[model samples]
Target: MTPNTARRNEASRRAVLTAAFDLLQEVDYAKLSIEGIAARAGVGKQTIYRWWPSKGAVLFDAFLMLSEGAGGEPPMLPDTGDLEADLVLVLRATVDELNDPRFEPPMRALSTEIAHDPELAAAYAERLDGPLREAKRQRLRSAQQAGQLAQGLDLEVAVDMIWGPVLNRWLQRTGPLTTEYTDLVVTTALNGLRPRGSSS
Candidate 1:
């Protein structure tokens, strides 16, 4: 397609996604529908179905777009060669994004659905979770190579150490997810949450 056509298509797609995002805030996942999305988007119902197989798919992509700079599909992590600083930088940004109203509603809905639906969970794993996990894992691997991460660290668990608390506070809304809290998570996870050299 020509550049103009490509741009127009992108704009139209974004409009559809934006409409879906807005609708998701007002309705639960089970109630969300492609017909409803197309109505909200000012497009034909077939337009939505032609592009996405399910409402979940549409919302997942919408969330991905909204969360782009907020630790989801970020162009790059804060790689200053200082692992703690880098991690704190990214995690702090993530906390701020999670706190934002734009990312909160759809995120809450999608996560809630994932708990009860195995099929949606698997689809989420393939499309959403895998990429995000891989991104975190890549950053951790970089830290290890830089000699900042612990040698022979279980990369998966190490990733959880960094990701868990931030997500916990963000999703559960149980505690403050301040920059200070993120900084502490960075320091604790990297240097061990216990006394120096003591197993956590």
Candidate 2:
């Protein structure tokens, strides 16, 4: 496509995605449809089909774009050289984001839909979880190199240890997310999982 055409296509795609997101905030994901998205975006229905196969894919992409921001890069995880501080920083930001009703609903809806739809779940795992897991692995590797983590730590397991408790709490609404909560997670993970000889 010509540069002008490419730019127009990009603009149209963004318009549709934005409309989908707005509709998600306004209506249930189960009630959302391509027709509504097209109407809201002022784009033809064919324009959406030309790019995405289903509303699930469109909503998935829209959520991904919204979560990742309009920019291409994933949101940064902090790396302040103090692993405990860095983890707390990022996780607290996560807590804030999860607690925000706007961010939480779309995520919850998508997660619920994925649970019932095996194909959607696989696509989500491939498109979202896979990249996030790799990013967490890199963060854990950096901590390991800094002598902050136990030698031969399983990076994937380590990521789970850090994320699992917080995610459970968020999903269950079982506890408040506070500085105290974050401190406990960081301290517990380090002390329980890291080598005894390792220093904070």
Candidate 3:
């Protein structure tokens, strides 16, 4: 493609992704449709179809774009040499994300939909959950290598242990998801993982 054509294609793609992201803040996932996205994006419906196979695919891509940090990289958990502090930082960010008005409604909507839709669940896992879990696992492994975590810890299970409670509260709405709650979860999990008698 010519330089101008490539620039135009990139611009069009950005427009669609931005429009979809913005629209989700106004409407639930069930109410979001390809036609609405195209209209909001000021592009032809075919323009979106040529890029994404379905509305869910478009939303998934938009979600990723929204979650990206500076330089278009997915947000990374911080590494501060203190495992507990790092975990708390990451978990607090998660709690804030879950509480964010722009993200919460769509995320909750998608979660409910995924429970009944196996295909959607798989897509969600592939795009979001799987990568996030892997990132957390890698951070835990780093702590183990630093001798901050107990030897022989099952990193995968440890990751689940760290995230499971936060996710449960998020999904069940059984309690307020606050900074204190996240800090408590992180402290509790790390206390168990730390080598015996090691200072937290």
What are the TM-scores, per candidate, against the unseen true structure? 0.76, 0.79, 0.80
List the pairs of residues colliding in candidate 1.
none
Please list the residue runs of candidate 1 whose C-alpha ends up more than 4 Å from where it truly belongs after superposition.
Answer: 1-14, 25-35, 44-53, 64-74, 197-200
Q: Top model by TM-score, which number?
A: 3
Model 3 alpha-carbon miss at residue 131, Å:
4.4
Candidate 3's TM-score reads 0.80
Candidate 1 C-alpha error for residue 99, in Å: 0.8
- RMSD (Cα, Å) for all candidates, in order, is 4.2, 3.4, 3.5
Clash counts for all predictions: 0, 0, 0
Candidate 1 C-alpha lDDT tens digits along 149-187: 778899999989888988887778889889999998888
lDDT by residue (22-139, candidate 3, tens digit) is 8888887788888999999899999999998777667677667665633555546788888888888888888888999988876776677678778878978887787777788888
**Superior by TM-score: candidate 1 or candidate 2:** 2
> Please, what are the lDDT tens digits per residue for candidate 2 over residues 1-200?
99999999989999998898788788988898889999999999999998998887787888777656756665346677888888888788878888787777777777777878899899888878777777777877988998978898998899999889988887778998776797789778878964666544
